[model samples]
Target: MSGIGVLREGPLHAAVKDLLARPGDVTEVKYGRYVIDLVRADGELVEVQTGGFSPLGPKLDALLDEHRMRIVHPVPAQRRIIRVDANGEVLSSRRSPLKGEVWDVFDRLVSFPSLLAHPNLTVEVLLCAEDHIRAPEAGRSRSGRRRRDPGERRLTEVVGSEVLASPADCAALLPDALRAEPFTTRELATAVGCRMILAQRIAYCLRGMEVLTDAGKRGRAPLHVIAA
Candidate 1:
């Protein structure tokens, strides 16, 4: 085991870590330059990455040569915002109107599109319910007076989780209308109900995973189709 212990993890990390661990498996195993999150019963390495994937690539590349690795990343399906005072007292709590979908993971996946293609790698995207804490940011209100600070948001809880594995799983996220059309970032955005930038990322990852292929051009936008 590495010097990093489960007891030291934050609210979200610790919760997800405990959820992924089995009865007899290990937590925080030191493997070469990295400290793995969990070592499963069959020697599979489970990594719970709560942040961007770009920095994880080199470390994973080193491990995947001989080990089976799974990247467990969480996407909050439902989020509650908890406002706290400077002294850490809870002020108010409310649910954010925006609910997250599994498709949202593409936003982060765009940062490292190639990882989806690693043969020895499997990704387990966990859709979860979480609480976000913040101190009001310093600013003025709509009336142009000094406004209460809305603090920086930090993850404070993990309420639930589910897995999304394989490119087929991601393909399922495409809406029926979009799945039938030649893929364009615009069509993808409309289908997924996300911004074009995020849709572009999803397309990039799908392409890297060999799930989509260039199907020439429709007007100016490059066209794509599900890979045959």
Candidate 2:
């Protein structure tokens, strides 16, 4: 054990937190206004965020003022959608056709573009297998939309991890095959065979991290290139 030993675990959040904690480390402790997820051996506070980053802005701001902090955000590389009835009986199960990539973290990073610049803040991106639990819905949701929340996300296992400790780390997400020339979002999207929106988000984070520089624009799209 590291710090205090596993204090407790239940939901996916706690389970992931427990797994990330150094053996014997404290699990949950109230510090200032936030209930920190784990306190490591060297005193770095670790928070496992499996949700959006918007809500964490204030929490991170408060903690980083006095302590070194790490945000462990997991991106599900493989997901299984398991639909169950209200009683928790499995009704249907299927592997989601969509696969997650490292760039997917940009979806959440868009919420806090400046957080990465903080000296005390580090983000550990974990690629993992997840189980998405949902309940059977009658028809359309109250929003009258086609998509609905997955209800709960349970992490089954970790695949790999990438640490973004500096602006250079952002380049790790880029493919080695990417040309060393200036590229627009459209070109990047076409090269990766991904949606333009995702490419835009990736570009946004790269620019924010100073890993990519704005090379002006082409037509109506912005151009970006790896910083020298």
Considering every candidate listed, which one attains the maximal TM-score?
2
List clashing residue pairs in candidate 1: 135-150, 135-151, 136-149, 136-150, 136-151, 137-149, 137-150, 137-151
Q: Which candidate has the top score in lDDT?
A: 2
Q: How many backbone clashes does every candidate have?
A: 8, 8
lDDT of 2 by residue, 1-228 (tens): 233323443367777886887765786777866677788878999888877888788888787878999988888899999999889999999999888877777888998766787889898889999998998765776788766655788889999988987676777667665657788888877776678899888788878888888888888877888878
lDDT of 1 by residue, 1-228 (tens): 455756656667767878778887998998877888899989999987777888777877789879888888877777888887789898889998887777777777877666666666777767777778877655777889987554433454445554545677667666778666686888888878888888888898889877888989989999988865
Q: Model 2, stretches more than 4 Å misplaced?
A: 1-10, 141-144, 147-149
Q: TM-score for model 2?
A: 0.87
Give per-residue lDDT, candidate 2, residue 215: 86
